[model samples]
Target: MHDRFDFLKNISPHHGEVLRNVLSKETRETLAAKLDVMPNGQTWYADIYQKAIYGPMVFRDPELNIIKTIEKLLPNYRILSDLYLEKTPDDQGFPFHTDFDSIGFMEHPEDMLTVWIPLTPVEEAGSGQLSIVMEEGAVRLSLIREANQLHSLVRVVDSSVPAHPPFQITQQEYDYLERTKVTPSLDAGDALLFCNAFFHKSEDVHNGKRSAYIMRLVRKDAKFNKTRLLALKKLGQNLAVVDELLKQHYPDAL
Candidate 1:
């Protein structure tokens, strides 16, 4: 399944660290070591990028743990999708964009977040590590909401197809993102959680491959849940994507 928790046992024991009991350090080390030795398989999630595999729900405890973590941070939240994995080659990197806009249609971008956990130790920026814009890019996000055109940001990356040319913001918006972009050094087991609407990109890998898992968290009782649901249906999201999303989120309903 390539999900983060799938290879928890592979992580090193002494390196063990848990963030709010949601992520384990040993699991991170194990996953990294595993990626280092395992032969690369067929590309997964080609539609989103070259290497990715959007598999079935692999871990339920992680989702519950995430729920507990979010509740500690802020209450009344639920997950929007299952644990998803992505593998990027040395050459593939993404352009500046927000997961909120790309996946959730920016319906309530501020209320959502994307948790990125790299299985392998990512080198400095431009070495297949994440580059995040440091400024308060949420100002632009506010404008999208005020204009009631939030949907414009959705579908930027089709979950069903490889995202060719990667999605980038408009030239005007690029100026802000470029000014604040910072690629921080991240070790295995370190989890990067950011606003879904935060401007971020990836550096091309010069070292080896990069493996990571991402999970989306949304408010269960968010004000715009209905609106988001309508947009997802209208977009004709792939059945597998939609089904897994619902399964992790509304397990009893399924």
Candidate 2:
């Protein structure tokens, strides 16, 4: 297992301290309240089981400032979208999957990134810790075929899809993955910067609430398909507004 500090190296050194502060208790409490009231406060599940708040990047809230700071630090990356809090019980958690498999954020799959920031301290011994599979190892498994469609960050597939490949694992499988996959412990202020291709999931919440905020970033040069954007808009997902807002921010992209 790698230390949490190793993951920090992936983040821009300029924004590391700022991100740490952004994930603090005060910020989390403030942001959590805003997220709790979003219009689409549900999960869409096709292969996994989980609940979350999605598309927070576009919300009119103080949290956007923190996201902007990260964008400034990583000028090449755009904050595509985000999910607020992820909640589950001791025996329930998401399946192991890559963010790339979920939504085609860019023209090329590799151009996307995600930051998984835990709002609570997670120890190795704790059941609700976030688990990650090493990038090198996950490449060997079959890539997830269909991205679990998320209505908002808060919802997941209501039931597992049998035709889809298994993403969720049993407790035994989790243990086996730990033996082969690198797991890291995280605190409230820490975040994991991972490529969309990295396979990851969370351990079931055995005790306290395990909340995390996930922000998706994409390469600026990548294309955002208008068709998909329109579909999301028709669904009334607030992401359509976010897309327009970002376009206004970077007129060159439009």
* Model 1 residue 192 CA deviation in Å: 1.1
Q: How far is 105's C-alpha from truth in model 2 (Å)?
A: 3.3
Off by over 4 Å in 1: 1-22, 29-45, 61-76, 83-91, 105-107, 141-149, 152-172, 238-254
For model 1, state the Cα shift of residue 82 in Å.
4.0
Backbone clash total, candidate 2: 13
**lDDT for model 2:** 0.55
**Cα distance off (Å), candidate 1, residue 133:** 2.4
What are the per-residue Cα lDDT tens digits for candidate 2 across 1-254? 44334433442222112244446577776766776676545546311334455565642455546666666557887776777665556335656766643454344544566677777776665546666655333433413322333222112322342444435546775565566555567777577666565456667776657777777777777676444444444444555543684465544544
| Residue-by-residue lDDT tens digits, candidate 1, 124-224 | 75446776643435335433532333444233223453333433457877776667566656666566665555556776765556767666666676444
What is the Cα-based TM-score of model 2? 0.65
Off by over 4 Å in 2: 1-22, 37-40, 45-51, 58-64, 135-137, 140-178, 225-254
Q: Rate the local accuracy (lDDT) of all candidates.
A: 0.50, 0.55
RMSD of 2: 7.6
